[model samples]
Target: MNTAAVVADFRTYPLISALGSVQTLADRVAVEWADGRISPFHHVWLRDNCPCQQCVYSVTREQVFEIVDAPDDLQPTAAHIDAEGCLCLDWHDGHRSRFDPGWLRAHAYDDQSRAERLAGQPQSHLWRSDLQLPVFEYTALMEDPAALLQWLIAVRDIGLTQVRGVPTAPGSLKLIAQRISFIRESNFGVLFNVQSKADADSNAYTAFNLPLHTDLPTRELQPGLQFLHCLVNDAEGGESIFVDGFAIADALRSEDPASFQALCEIPVEFRNKDRHSDYRCLAPIIALDALGRVAEIRMANFLRGAFDTSVEQMPRLYRAYRRFMAMTREPRFRLMQRLNPGELWCFDNRRTLHARNAFDPATGARHFQGCYVDRDELLSRILVLQR
Candidate 1:
């Protein structure tokens, strides 16, 4: 095949003016961009990512190229910036590939590019009681994509949101969850009733002053999102409480760095063993992402198992644990509300610690149906709506 003819054809395209100088490296092609940035595309990567109909299925947009069959010593024999501003390459294995420079720049893996990508991720807004929680009406959420998108974005960023005027009936919780994605079934069914029960296996089923905690921390993969629909909340007290675990962690980090580090370094055991199921997991109380940002908080004092750390580390762990618990209960970090009937509360289980004030069940009935959904589904729905 004549390589000159391919370059001449690309030159006729409208985007050719954006093309810059190109050089062939030992095993890749370095294309300089009009913005004074250079992006290096490996020969094998270029070949595997070829946008040609023969390499990629036109209908499915799936790759047809076999990575294993690609030559191990593949390198660009001839490379240049085509008239279409694409990095045109002629490989030693007689294979050709053309990559859009814009695409390459957008996907560059350099340090600056990676940092920018991370910065572009959805940011969380820390809040206290003063911050008015974003609320969406159930009817609007069901009928309008914009309303649903707004609620989903708030839940993703703030880790909490409320929906009012939901139908107060059984299975309504699951119906609303279905609007986001499939319900994440666990030891608790897809939809579990949250009323006081005799001989309750969990503290949540009782009418006691439950301390602030994340649910099901004993599980290795804890649920990311939680939905609590207040079907009937007429009892005295039992006000719902929420604390931004991430915000508290950040506060701890600022106030006492040593305690925060200890919480992040020590792995505490959480176990839930009953006649029906035995679940246990070990994880740090404060979890950080690759960038050292607070990402998750797993704390359940009720379900915490025996402290299995060194004697010397025990005191430090206890100090850190107490510090974290104290911060969670602080009024400056807590948001308390009495969820009325026909209201549904949704929050990020991984980042928000929830609790309930003691209520007298004998006074009136207080029922709430609850369920879980993975965070990916919530974010996925938001992305689809944005598109």
Candidate 2:
């Protein structure tokens, strides 16, 4: 059946109370909780998500039922609430399933429940320049799960942290990165060298001053976490600069709501073309998650393509862009530091704008090994360590 017909048939089930009354309609069932919340579950979904050993593997906890094999008009032959407040179902196909009421309530797709879940998501702790950067020792991070968890939490909450005393040897950055998760390979390979190189593919390979911006905004899925390990820094003038993009965006919202709104509304194009790859994407400079919280800040003047908006909107977009750029450079938001050899600086690429000052590449050598990791993996590692 078509999607609309399926949805229509699914909702035909009457709402039933878990404690007071039980009701079942064609191919569906509804459960009303003690808290007066009612939710309908389609028989197909219930059968697919069945927790029985026959439907789901007991050890691996993975679904074993094949949805395509089930009958399209399948309905529950018998439905009732068990003593433990579980919805027990006997299907027309001679199958039995029981679903916990709490699980059903939590997994409900109703508007109110979805909104509540989004609102309950974890939010970042925006930081300003005055905040001290969280630092952890390499040994502690490698040996103690507690220390590693603390570092991951700091990166998630504050967008940046440092691990000192990392091995300065070549390719050691990959080892440190793997401690959290697998490296995300880009056009620059699994681990790219950050040094002044002749005929460089990107500006990052030069000694020129790089502006505060997120990396690879041209790609649809930008890297989440970035690790830059300072293996050599004998150069004179290459001070690393960082700014909390979310913090700056928040400040802009307070100081100039119009500009903030413009930034959040207008979509800007970011493009990167080279001999090997040509990448492009269109996204707002300030992106918000479903709950209206800052999720990502995609800005890179070097990679930004020509404006494609109308004449009327161009002026407003430029004003907003200029205002946001100025805020990123404000003294109160900028943090400057010279990373020492054996120090690994990791930051949330989505929320942090990193820059580099012009260095005298001719005078002395400066080098760093860099890699990318997804934010989900970092959070997963944190959760596992906590457990």
Q: What's the TM-score of every candidate structure?
A: 0.90, 0.81
Give the alpha-carbon lDDT of every model: 0.84, 0.85
**What ranges in model 1 sit over 4 Å off?**
1-18, 51-68
Ten residues in a row with the worst lDDT in model 2?
A: 1-10
* Model 1 lDDT on a 0 to 1 scale: 0.84
Q: Which candidate is the best by lDDT?
A: 2
lDDT of 2 by residue, 1-387 (tens): 121211211112222334434579775677667667767777788888877778766566667789898888888889988766667889888988876555565567767777877776667888888879899999888888888888888999899999999999999998878889999999999999999999899999999999999999998888999999999999899999999999999999999999999999999999998998999999999999886888999999999999888899999999999999988888999999999999989999999999999999878899999999998999988877764
TM-score of 1: 0.90
Candidate 1, 21-76: lDDT as tens digits: 88887777676667676667677777777766667765666678897888888777
**In model 2, where do residues sit more than 4 Å from their true spots?**
1-48, 57-60, 64-86, 100-116, 383-387
